[model samples]
Target: ADSLSCVRILRKMRERVSESISKMKADMSRAEEQARREYERERRHEYDSAAYLISMNKQSAEKSKAALPHLLTMSDHLGVDLLHLSGSALSTVFDMKEMSSLKS
Candidate 1:
């Protein structure tokens, strides 16, 4: 896909992840324990699947550039302490997008 398409996909994924995390954390009146458990389970599932994808021997600074922040945020929701992966690559992808926009 083109850079613009990549950016759009990234934005959509970010919005979905943010919305899911927000809903999982909203309102904890009485069912606090239950909600916490559910959120934990969701996090584990998301993280596990992502880990599997990353392990497919295809992830790299270039190949997975657009996914760095999305993975970071998702891992954050999963409470997984992590450093920014492929950070420079992600920035390069965004920078390329900016340059492309200028030419468009």
Candidate 2:
């Protein structure tokens, strides 16, 4: 990884102990910043991905909530089959604990 590479480079610079020690120190600073930026970028990306999935799950739950009444009305017309179908649909939808977990 870039971090390990940075460490190796710093070790080499230290062992050499040439006139460019000052320049190597500056290089190390830059390497540290690069590693920090890379870490932040990866973290931000993961956060965004998780947030997007949570938003989608919440959207699906909202859709299911909205459809429940309509499903009930249709079930009244379709009888047992629709009743079972709606039950299965309800089970697939996220419950309160699931929603809370997604938020966290």
Candidate 3:
């Protein structure tokens, strides 16, 4: 009877241990999946930000293209030398040909 009781106790312990291991494995898998999802979310955000900047850059280039002729005319009428403008200000103007090359 004593040995039978010991055997039953051992079986119950084994069952509990198996359950605990399974629970641990499940928890680890969930943690890994969460980490993977977070990484994907971060990458998606980076791509979205890059796309937004590219769209803004294209819009700015178009506006510059449309305004260039009028701006040059005004500068000439006002006797303003564009070449004497600050380098930083000049850098904001994108030539259409230069912009095309940058896309590739």
How many clashes (backbone N, Cα, C below 3 Å) per candidate?
Answer: 0, 0, 0
The residue-level lDDT of candidate 2 at 32 comes to: 42
Best by TM-score: 2
Decreasing lDDT order of the candidates:
3, 2, 1
Which numbered prediction scores highest in lDDT against the true structure?
3
What's the distance in Å from true for residue 76, model 2? 0.6
The Cα error of candidate 1 at residue 70, in Å, is 9.9
What candidate 2 gets wrong by more than 4 Å, as runs, is 1-47, 86-104
- Between candidates 1 and 2, the lDDT winner: 2
The C-alpha stretches of model 3 lying farther than 4 A from their native spots are 1-47, 83-104
| Global CA lDDT computed for model 3 | 0.44
Scored against the true structure, residue 86 in model 1 reaches a CA lDDT of: 40
TM-score for each prediction?
A: 0.25, 0.35, 0.34
The Cα local distance difference test for each model comes to: 0.41, 0.42, 0.44
User: What are the root-mean-square deviations of the candidates from the true structure over C-alphas?
Assistant: 16.6, 26.7, 32.2
Candidate 2 at residue 34, lDDT?
Answer: 55
lDDT of 1 by residue, 41-100 (tens): 556646676544443322222223333344457667655432433445433433322112
- Please provide, for model 3 over 14-38, each residue's C-alpha lDDT reduced to its tens digit, 9 standing for 90 to 100: 3444443344335434544554565
